[model samples]
Target: MNTARLAADLVEELDEGGLRGSFLVRDLHTGREIGIDPDVLFPVASLIKVPLAAATAERIRLGELDGSAQLTVQPGRISTPGPTGLTRFRYPARIAVDDLLYLSMSISDGVAADALFGLTPPAEVNRLLRAWELHGITARHLLGALSDTPAERLPAEEGHLAHSLAISSGTSGRGHRIQQLDVARANTGSARAFVDLLQALWTTSKIDAVVQSRIRELMGTNLLRQRLAPDFTSDATTWFSKTGTLLNLRHEAGVVEHADGQAFAIAALTESRISAVHQPEAEVLMARVARVLRDHLRHG
Candidate 1:
């Protein structure tokens, strides 16, 4: 099967489902790639946590921060509307920097991500990416701001406001307030840039091998495997990925490596026109698209 042609057909299928998507697949060993609308930017949602994790690892390597150091999670210290891992706790708790990285990357924990952002700051994360020459990617706002409620209401541990915001955003029509928060000012990235980042992380000599291994391990343990993993993973294959999800956006970026040593970097980003609160088909379509790309490359 022709990968490029198949990718185009998949895009059309997604369009029929009221979705617009971008895809990129690169052979890590040969440096050859295929893409459809790969340069178009999409709201990355929680995918930004990948870069945040990289920055934190870099800081640990540089002795600027300690991964084992315990940080207290006070009330209102970090808010994301939805709490996961340590963020789900009521009273204050202490967590290590390394564990925080795990929660942020593996489970897309918003509070864990915001806490790391507090330590490294969004601007600093962007600066680190720029230094690495990844100019097309941006991590602009903290995860808490993505929620629809006011800042004071943000720290609600129950996640009621976040759930309500997600529903309203998905159901609203064009030009809705959620659109403003997402398209106008949300974290953004192109499929190609994300693939490039993954490639760098996989093959670059600049990042310490130990740190790189740790990051990959955390990503490999991601619990949300319904998006891209279901298609490509098997006994001889493993996927290391981070997923991003919001009202109408669903994305996953990662590297899939086979036991035979072939590895490919893949990024699939999508936006939907469906204005319903639930769209399970959107997730399934995204995975189908990914499976097509993976099989095309693996057996082509």
Candidate 2:
């Protein structure tokens, strides 16, 4: 099939599947690539943790912050709702900065991420990205801000309405009535931006070596594996990835390293027209589209 035709088909497939996404797959060694609007930006939900972990680890490496330092999170302090990690804990817990890093990346724990955010705010994270010459990703608010949205305050029966609001209340400029969904106010990134970051992380360039490696290990153990991991994981390949989700947005970014020394950096950031949460089919379709790009790049 011709490349342009394939992309056209993929775009139609995505539209029929109720999603529109920015996806890219690149061979890290050759720099060859395949993508579908990979430069389009989307509000990154928990994907902000990848950079947070990196910056926090870099600070630790620079002796500016102690990873072993403990922060006690009272039960009431877990203000955000999450399926795993410290958010689910019901008692006061003294957790180390290093462990908080693990929980934030591995389990998508908002409480742990905000605690780390308390140490290194969004501005400092952006500063580190600028210092490292990383561009296109903007970190603006704490993870708790995501939890305080209209979606969270809605009743169970009104969940789909929240999704509808998310889908419709956006401007042409990527601005939204919801602050967390607005690119200017939210943690946002493009597939190209994330793939660039992944390339740097994998190559250990533009970032401290120890911190880069630690972020990889954290992503390798990431617990939110239902998105891109299924398509990339195998005995001959290792998938290190992170997932991000808001009301109608879903995304994943990572590198898949094959045993034969071939590695590909992948970024799939998507938004859905469907007005419901728990869209398992959307997750599957997201992976399939990304896998097509990966296979196309890997074989070329």
Candidate 3:
């Protein structure tokens, strides 16, 4: 497989798309990174949940938290409308820690994330970030700006209270005269930092391998499935990845373990050309990289 040529081709396509910001692709097994922009910060979108899941697992390992433990979604647990907020539940739902993680990461469930955040504090999330050494560009830095006030606000669409706002409306509220918390850019991360976070998950024995496996399983629960998986699926390659999208961003990051035991970790973040719409162009960019990498290893 022509690895360098594939890498060059992907970069050429990204340049053609007019995508701004950083991108990084690394083979975890060989520790060889084959892409560019290793240290540029961009919005992480739902990709935030990947590290959040890891942080939650770390907490469980320290005996500070429990995955099987149950918690009820209360009024105070309501968050702003987003991919995973409670927009349709008639009654307070009861779920477990593992379920919350699954919902949060797999489905990008905002309600599940709020449920976890409700049980703990944003500070706790930050604590986990610090443990992972991901405190610099994490949600904790933006939580106060995004979800600072806990007034038990209702979902803007429905009558029930949902605390966090969705990306579309959240971005609109920025710099408005009204008193609203604008979180369109609530959480941000650099492409390099995100890959580093994944590196920690794949390489660190801090969290049990079994727990890491669970995290990967949940990441695969993406509903949109708009990332590298689609491009490489025809090859029968096993892909464990997570995807996040906003108005101007699309991100996917995960580890691919070949049947031959060759594993690679890749994280692609893009600010698309279309400024205000969710476009597949960013994901398409990611697919190109995935295709190049797959060919690189397949032919080699």
Candidate 4:
């Protein structure tokens, strides 16, 4: 199979639809890889959690932090505006640090992710990446900070509707800028670099095997499957992935293992020109492209 040709064809098709995308697929067993614009930077959205998880695990391994320790979470402090997990809580709550890690990665929980980021700052996460020789990625800000509106940062007010409006307005402006592919101000990475990170996580003997296994386990339980997982996953084939979404950007990266012992690391990141808040077709397009690449790798 001419994997390169297939990738080019896929890119052409995506371009005709007014979408910009970057993809990379590497067969872990065979060292075969394919990509299209895989080195170009894209906004990573929640995908940044993978590195944060790695950093936290490393800290725990070094005995610098206790993953099992309880952390108190208040509604306004370290909270991001989102509907999932801890962000939905109306009041203060106590959660285990390790469990928070699970919530952040498995469910893409914004609040839980921000909480972990507080413990492992973005600078520390980037430093670990550099030490590991994964230089294609950057962790510059907490998840909450990425989408935070000025209104959200303001002191809590008595009127809920007024606060909601303010948040909505701020989010709209941020979304506009993000839709422009503002890489400088967003958490960014290239598909090829992300593949390198996944490879390191899977093949590196430098990190504790237990930590690697835990990261994979949490990723396998990820709730967002509309992008790459829906196309490559089956009862026999398993996908351990993390997804990132913000406005017009959609991305998923993970390792897909087949029942027959074949495994591949895939990163599919896309941006659509459509301004509609909900663009189901963009998600479907990503899934379809992934399926094309996976099939070609398996049988092409």
TM-score of each: 0.86, 0.96, 0.74, 0.86
Please give me the total number of clashing residue pairs in predicted model 4.
1
lDDT of 1: 0.78
User: Which residue pairs show backbone clashes in model 1?
Assistant: none
Find the candidate with the highest lDDT and give its number. Answer: 2
Residue 251, candidate 3: Cα error in Å is: 0.7
Lowest-scoring 10 consecutive residues by lDDT in candidate 1? Answer: 171-180
lDDT per residue (tens digit) for residues 130-239 in model 2: 89899999898888776777776777677889899999999999999998998888899999999999998998588988888899999999988999999989999999
lDDT of 4 by residue, 1-300 (tens): 376677778888887765779898888877788778889887798889998999899898889989999999766444434447777777888999899999999888878988898899989999988888788888877787545643344554433433334223334233333322356666789898888878878876465787788888888899877777778778999989999976556888999988988889999988766544456777888878877886787786
> What's the C-alpha lDDT at position 120 in model 1?
97
Tens digits of per-residue lDDT, candidate 3, 207-250, equal 56866766767765656566777774535466777777654457
Tens digits of per-residue lDDT, candidate 1, 10-96, equal: 878888987788988899999888777899877788889998999999899889999999888654333443345655556777889
The CA lDDT at 300 in model 3 is 55
Candidate 1 vs 4: which has more TM-score: 4
Best by TM-score: 2
Model 4, residue 196: distance off in Å is: 1.1
